[model samples]
Target: MSVLADFERVDSDSGGAVLRFTGNLSLASLGDLPDRLDRVDGQVARIDLSQVARIDTVGAWVIHRFARDREAAVEGLQPASRHLFDQVVAAEHPIELPPKPESPFVHLLAEIGDAVFTAMHTLYGLLGFMGATVIAFWNVATHPRRFRFHATVHRFEVVGVSALGIIGLMSFLIGVVIAQQGAVQLRQFGAEVYTINLVGRITLRELGVLMTAIMVAGRSGSAFAAQIGTMKLTEEIDAMRTIGVSPMEALVVPRTIAVVTMLPLLGFYSALIGIIGGGLLCWVQLGIPPITFVQRIREVVPLDDLWVGLIKAPVFGAIIAIAGCFQGMQVEGDAEQVGRRTTTAVVQAIFLVIVLDAFFAVFFSQIGWI
Candidate 1:
């Protein structure tokens, strides 16, 4: 049976109160003692635990806190109770927490700085990876037999041929939307015929290659990341290195070459499909015959627009491939890392593609291609 803890105050020789505790000083028996101790007052110079029976850590903590708060000495503790009291004293400590920002503005500035730092760090890593890839490409170039033709062809089917259906559907829909909107605006000016020029120029020069890059980044880029990330997690990449196989040449180079080669063909096909969609829309809505629409597109849209898209396509493909493979190479630790890297790869690829497209537009315009 547990005895309920109890204490009483008695005057000592120094005329200071001494709190003499009795009965069991344990977790089960000391329930109301803590609250009662908090209500204590007066000049308590010592705490007498000589009569305390069956003491535990709970009792030790309560007695130690009371003594410390009253600036009183603890006495009459048995050997076991003394050790427990010492332990409780040693364990008392304040927890440290992360410091808060001084103000909201400072917090915002800190976040912006972190973002900039991360961006710069990522850019530096990507540039180094690009350099390594170039060295790998050079090694393969010098030794043509080292090239993996079969792997490259397989990637071509995966990245390009498999992508055609969705790319075609998306491009066709975009073309129809462009033509429908262009016709609506042009009709107000009594120039619905010019909708052909709008659809042709925009799709061929900008939307066709741009949209294709975005889709490939989301589809094939994520796959590249997930595939290589899984390889990394399983130690297959390390095994390849151990066996004297170059991961860059065997894996990265094939993917890079495949995407770079296919993007231009895909872009051209997308542009053609988009133009056909616009022609159908024009025929159905604006009463313009398909033959006349085709003639107008051929007359108004320059061959330079097609060249601009083709030129941008390979660059976009290289960016997407490199970003995906680089993120995949970075994956480590766990399966969750694979998913995170895949998402990062897609986002990074699409962002780079759009940025490069803008620069291409400026360059092409400056060169009098627009």
Candidate 2:
């Protein structure tokens, strides 16, 4: 097709210049249009479209781009040509947008509001989950045969038995380090024998259960989220619901009970192992014999200290289980969501465990139990 188009300067005796459009001003006839437009570089005081026989949107756009900032007056446009020109002109000189500025205090307030809402929403979900779990337990209590015995046993093995070696080793190492450090410090006051008291009281009252809870939150809590999240992704939970199975009963209760049942036992075992490690360290490094260390521990460490750690264990276990299961239930069948929820479960479980531990400490101190 002939892409023929041209424009010319109409010399005017008046003060301003005029540009006259001639020939087919259409896309097909737009040859050298931009270059030709560039040639009309001087003042464009007027544009006369009356001589143009035909034009298209592209031609309209070319004219608009050329004349938009030139303050030129256009004349003799038919209705259709005027509409096209108006469209192109509006497009070329779009409305300018202004920026909105925010104060730093307002931004900080918005962030705080968002965080508070998120925390409240999480807490609400956890309460709902706890209620459902309680109902599931009630059902199992009445209909004993409906309990998932095999699943509970399996979880006990996974959450309890599988964790023993690492827990024991970590507790032992901690006890050894504390004893060694305590001996060095106490020797400054010629009271190195007090190392036994430090190891016994700290292990039985705080470190053993606290460390176990933290580890289990990272280990079993994440595992719970991953497992339940995978099941959620595969729609197994939905399928169970359709088949009249309560997911709380089938999935959540068994895991929760298993961990709750096993945590106190594990805490006791950890405390025992830690004390043994400390005793060994004392015997080897401080020249205090194992029997003497054991006697010292018994005399200095109250039975209440052991009870304090034991009491915290089951509560920590329940928090870990609920956090994991709650996050798992919230998963959206996405791989990224599964990973995110698993991480969230571990973090929330650990945070709650620590917070609960703190409250317990305060309560114990207030009641003179410390």
- The clash numbers for all candidates, in the given order, read 0, 0
Candidate 2 stretches with Cα past 4 Å from truth are: 1-59, 62-101
Instruction: Tell me model 1's lDDT, rounded to 2 decimals.
Output: 0.94
Error of 2 at 88 (Å): 6.0
Clashes by residue pair, model 1: none
Kindly state the number of residue pairs that clash in model 1: 0
Every candidate's lDDT: 0.94, 0.89
Give the local distance difference test score of model 2: 0.89
- Residue by residue across 100-212, what tens digits does model 1's lDDT show? 74798988999999999999999999999999899999999999999999999999999999999999999999999999999999999999999999999999999999999
Instruction: Check candidate 2 and list the clashing pairs.
Output: none
TM-scores of the candidates are: 0.83, 0.79
Per-residue CA lDDT of candidate 2, range 68-180, in tens?
A: 76778888788888988888777664576886878999999999999999999999999999999899999999999889999999999999999999999999999999999
